[model samples]
Target chain A: MADIILNPYYMQIASFILINIILGISIYITLSTGLLSLGSAGFMSIGAYTSALVTMKLGFPMPLGIVSGAMVAALAGILVGIPTLRLSGVYLAIATLGFGEVIRVWFNNLEITRGALGIPGIPQMGREITGSLREFGITPDMLGLRANQFSALILFFILLILVILTVWFFVRLQRSRIGRAYAAIKADEEAAEAMGINTTYYKVLAFAQGALVAGFAGALYAHTTSFINPGDFSYHRAVEILIFAVFGGSEVIWGPIFGAAFLTLMPEVLRGLADYRFMIYGVLLIVMMAFRPQGIIDYQVLDWLKKKVKRNKSASPLDKQKGGDA
Target chain B: MKKWMKVVGLIVSVMLLLSVVACGSQGTSGEGGEQSGETESGEKVAKIGVISYLTGDGAAYGEAITSGFEMARDELNEKHKGELKIELVIEDSAGKRDQALNAAQKLINSDNVLAILGPTLSSEMFVVGPEANAAGVPIMGTSNTAKGIPEIGDYVFRNSIPESLAIPAALKKAVDEFGIQKVAIIYGSDDDFTVSGYEVMKKAAEDLGLEILTTEEYATGDTDFSAQLTNIQAAEPDAILASSLYKEGGLIVDQARKMGLDVPFVGGNGFNSPQFINQAGEAANNLVVASPWFPERDDAQVKEFVAKFEEKYGKQPDQFAAQAYDALYIMAQAILDAGTVTDRDAVRDALANIKDFDGVTGDFSFDEIGDPVMEPVVLIVKDGKFVEFK
Candidate 1:
């Protein structure tokens, strides 16, 4: 178990899965509210560059860098969301898609970002912490960590905690007043406004929260990869985030998580396919969608399963009562 | 319920099918391992990983690179029979940074390759280089020519001459031949390679005391160049200096010629390809470019390599193939010189100390920074073919 946990390759993949889950859920938040904003990658880039610059150029700690990164992305979200959230469905997707391209070009033109050359050698997260731990005579090898695994393990734990926190927040938000407002707005914006739901405010709020979560994922990604460039966050990536939500079934929180993990791992598992892996991946997605258009874990399926279990429990008691009467 | 069960059954069956396919490949790989193990009992095996864009925009370059390396491996293995063997584990990066990073990790941690070659593009290199450096594995790039590549770490090395070196040579040749007093610059600003190449050309032109005309920038994949070309034509410089990939570079030249602003074009390394000539058609004539590999060179090694590559691949090897061929030789020679195939530090040291090594790419050596120090040959397009510039 220790060996498996400390395996660098698995740890790396797991860390990436966690990050993708965050991205998946981030887009899921907007999807649930009937908003098809394809700007998560833009938000991610803002978070990655901001956090990387904060830590590397400004000499701030990783925590401060992460906070500032998420804050900045959320701020941008509020700013962009307010104006663009008025557009809905495919139009909103196109507008947000343009927003992503603008951010990419903006980073490409900035001197501080070093234009297209990008910022390389950004200090990796957990390096300092590990070093300080070593100074305290608590060496990683004593705990069975191998070369480069120590930092990877540290990153894994941090990502795990963040994923848990995000999931918890998502669950809580679904039951809150904001969540009901989101549902109402998604069902019918006109009706939601008629009910005094302030549809715009709630929509923007969901967008901002999505941005904040995506920002957190980006900051972690920048540090995990230990590098950042504008090309890393493009329109394709935004679409990929959307795919995770859609393919996993956007109706439930578990959908995106399942979708992201399965998709991310599918590539690795498909590696054995050699040259045919990508083709196979595409075919599989097409097949899955054909069969389960609502996603692998559709809300209707979950609801049916819940009702069936309840019925089975009630039927057993009824059968016992019938037997007693006989 | 029946439909739900059917979907579940289908999902499970697809996963099972995939896993079965995966296992079959794994079994084959296992057999390959044993085959190598059975050879010479205790003989050393040098495991090397190649990360290239096997299926994407950069697939052509990746294909050329991997085929070059494969040819080198076969030839080297035959030459060193019973002494040392080489095993290559190739991974496709698909031209993405994260995929390259994953490839690097798999190479370093899982396969434990002694060295790595290529993630193809410079953009991919930026992400993969640091990871290899951190993990204490040497990585060499055959096609990454951007600045600061070698500066990633001591473990990072590249034999591909940067645009900083290649551009100046071409520019100087153009300046002397055309007697140009002023030059216009154009580049794709959104890409790392073109951006770096542009900076080099701009600085080289300034250093040559040429008057700077108008500088135009365009993003990659932009089809229309009328706007940038119009500005350059208005400047009416004696020559045009461009730093862009072949697609955009070719279009710009073709457009400028159509607009009657045809003086001459001195292009960076990106314009050295046959594709550029094909893309620009007759406008490609008199275009100047510099490269370390010249297929038409009369040198015996160059002639032999070109012949063998053509025989094997049924196509003439490009600059990328020649560079990759030499890169593999350099890496293999380093492993041999290190005398311990598994010792990465020793191989890196050996690689760093390589000097005056002759290959198809001309005399090559790594400076202290691990960037190659090699002379580039300046050539001009004449009658739709590259010829040595006078």
Candidate 2:
């Protein structure tokens, strides 16, 4: 067991986590706006292929390649989003699905995306035994630290900062007037439209933000995996991200975290289960939805937790009468 | 419940159950996708179907090999008159087992091919090979490298050596030639090809008394290898025996080099492609691989075949193409020998008794399990070309 834990495969599991965390955070951004535009996977494929092409063909510096990949993907997201913001719910899902499929087919046909041959030989980032800053002579011992501990530390913290930034923005959005506008859109768009909130603009912003995160994740994934194919970023993967958002409760800041953790570990935990693993996954999804329709902990539960102290033990008749009247 | 609603609900449940069953068995790409489309068959021609993963993850390999096979079919059709006309129908497996199996059924039942060329995944081969065999059709797996596949049925045939034969000798050759001691075995944990090859390598490595210093596993979709390379670097193995297909193999070698893990990397049959070279850049120049086909062989027959293939495709054919070329020749031989395509049983029996039929992959002969009994080619990637080594 110890040997397995220290195996390089474990490092790969961490790699999976790094990419998923980026995606989870990306999905988290859209969930915050109360608008699940559901099209980030398209952007992910765009970024992945872009980084793969640049890195493999142009030989750009790893960091530059990743950033450019993300930038290109975000641009694509903006382009796709401009035409898709008018649809709501099922219509939005269908359009986004079309976008995903279009990217898939385009990648399948484009000579540049290698048209399914897939781009290989991407330069890997982060070190296994040594941290990057150590190359500049700031060894862990020199900085009073253990060696090899922080060489790839920046990548993780980069992901952490992304998550933190997204959460902070989300919480801020939840409290702001515009955030309230998003909530109104989520709860009832018709009333929000009557109230003068520009639903289209907010929805477009939400889609753009979500797509941006997916692109960032995609770029990071390209650098980390050092290889990618059209198969990696498919419509099924978009659903995986949605599953992550929903599984994490979709209400609290840590919802994506919960979802990412579960999905990431679920496959590993079920490694012993072999072919039965996917069946179990489907079953788990059904069980979770049946028991916890709003997810394990959503906004309502958190609000309840906050107002738990010093409340009247029972509803007074006047309060009850007021509640009943309402 | 209302009658129609209850009927609809039952239909939905049955659909789900049927899909689950289909997926579990690894045949048919769901219901009515292609099976219904196979309505006509040419009785005069010997029709063969290639259920290949032509446009997805393994697309490069599939496309490359099929190019060679397709070329052979064109040339064969030109040569043969009314006796044994060979026709190949290209269908995309999309790397799905059910799809491949469904393709096999369609080819056999509707297209009524005397033989089928593929179902590339070992699991898919497991699913479809038996049925093809039972129906008296010989299945020539162009690139199913996983061992024990021929056991699916007696009528199944593949043009490549199984892992048992390939892995042990390949390792012995590496150990003898490279003088390697410790080895780092890296493979994809998800796919049966890599996993099966890894298991064989594990035993062969142990039996050879080589130390398994670091065994790293990565999922099929994982692209990052820094941490794993780091750990392998720390272990400082003399060689890295990677059981990966082209894309991952390219990334593994590239990353291992970037991390300064400068050991020579050895790959399985998956490395026998031009795409790997294109992907691995200069780093692929010195990579060693154990393959089943050598495009640059000096054999008289080989030279002629290579000349014909290159002339037709306008590019050098990879191992997959060579293997598929051999597989098609094998079918052609059986068909010509049997003297009729309508007697599927005779065709299957003729293929079963095949012996010493010199083809591109090598002397073709089928073991009792219907697998090609052949030797693995020793290859070293040199300056954007595959050079055959002793």
Candidate 3:
């Protein structure tokens, strides 16, 4: 029990932190644009299997395999997004959810994807393809640090930084012309379109960007877990991510991130209520929706805090002037 | 306050309290030997944790595993009169890795189970393994057959076979003993069980210097294999090894015969279900697989168990059932050997020390890792039932 909080075995779940974080941020990206996409899990599977296959079959380097996996997922995202650009709100969610299922079933039936009996010993990049290369007769240097603790944490922060950077870019985008176009489109698509804004192009870009994050996250996920199967990317998972987005608050950049972390840790927190965990989860979700629809905190709090600080600083100057005049 | 808000607050508080109680399974009964918690010393009363995929895709197989464990508990309790007490705490896993982890944790933390059995999928075990190990509890996966030790470090045990041993041995028997050549390989690609089968089968074929006529894949729940059969026939393989779980395996064999591919198909432990032939009807005959335990494996203990299972269930015990019965008995044996119900480390070591502990599956021995050494049964499908073959 003492070691339950941190065990070498926990490295798997911890490594997955990057996956959830990336997924959360990706969902955040879509939520920021006043759109929601539930197809990240599907895109992840595409990336995971594609990356895993290339690494295992072609014996490619780990980085290339992961990148290829992301590229493949991104490509599929664009392909799906091109035709579904006009759809939004629940319709978009449904379309993306269906799209995910179709992709899952396709992977399930495909000869290379291996159907139900998923591929085993999936050549987890760190597990098989390492610096040692003993099997390849090219022992450059073994990834001799036995436990993947450092790498797992490192990968997590690296992904966290990427999410931060993406958000920073999103912040910039929200202030830019394209960002204005998106805001206008979100406020009213027809009104923005009347003003000559290309809603379809911006919407497509939003879908593609969301998918790129999902794909990149998926690649990282494949390498970290070293295994992937059709089961991992079921439609239910996509819905779960959507829940994360909605629960955390759809309108904020950090909403999805919080949602992902909250849900991931929720099971553990609710461990005492073992039998009724899911029931409680449902009730809690309804409660949150009915009450705190804006989430635990919103971005306006930041602005309020910023203004309060500025007011105090400016008040100091006025006080000094008043004292000198007296 | 809004009536809904109060209701929500009450619900949240109750949920929090329940969780606290659940995690309280870690509560030790002090030096009193747990006498305070029971109804009475003479009254039969003990709690056991049963973790499984009771509600997900693995539910069908997981149900069998739990029932098997329950069956053993019933027998033990009834046989010992009221002196031996037992209660089963059954938890459903959604088959997600995280769900498995939570279920297992709740079982250990809240239920105060002496030991847990199941979580039939390898992926679940991979995720839940560490927590069980950290908590110093024993978790036995009755049906997962993936390679390598569980992610829970080393405290976990599985009464299953890995592909590295089972697949090659079965294929060799097909080629060398049966004099079969030019085999076709059809398996599920998306599952680790089936995909591992492909890699092992391919390697074994290449090593044995046997030629593969064609290789094929099937999707889960896809009943038709006529397309794969067409490709198989074109190559003219003498035999086929269709690696899939029971549902699709049965259909593949049935469809193969319907399509006129009469070659004898070898299967893995995935073939060890009575439903396979029952579902396929007469088409199931002549199909063979490397089973974990043979009905006629010449083990008297297994024979006795099967006699009872047959009488009770009105069906022959499949490999999963047999493995389940044996897994519980072996776990109980480890507990008794450890001589203390409270210490998890002692029980784990006692489990590790198991050697030649005979049960239905064969001698239950543990290597450094907690994998049981069970006999591999090669059975041929005959008249919609498995027949043990040399």
Candidate 1's docking class is: medium
Q: Order the candidate numbers by lDDT, best to worst.
A: 1, 3, 2
TM-score of each: 0.94, 0.51, 0.71
Fraction of the true interface contacts (Cα pairs closer than 8 Å across chains) found in each model: 0.57, 0.00, 0.25
Error of 1 at B221 (Å): 1.5
Better of 1 and 3 by lDDT: 1
Worst 10 contiguous positions by lDDT, candidate 2 chain A = A145-154
- Stretch of 10 with least lDDT, candidate 3 chain B: B28-37
Question: Candidate 2 lDDT, tens digit per residue, B107-173?
Answer: 6654556778887666567656754654567788887877666766667778777777777777787
lDDT of model number 1: 0.88
Q: Please give the DockQ score of every candidate, comma-separated.
A: 0.57, 0.01, 0.19
Q: What is the interface RMSD of each candidate, in Å?
A: 1.6, 17.9, 6.1
Which residue pairs of candidate 2 clash? A131-A151, A224-B224, A225-B223, A225-B224, B28-B98, B28-B102
- lDDT of residue B102 for candidate 2: 42
Quote the lDDT for A49 in model 2.
75
Query: Residue B299, candidate 1: how far off, in angstroms?
Result: 0.8
RMSD of each candidate? 3.9, 20.9, 7.9
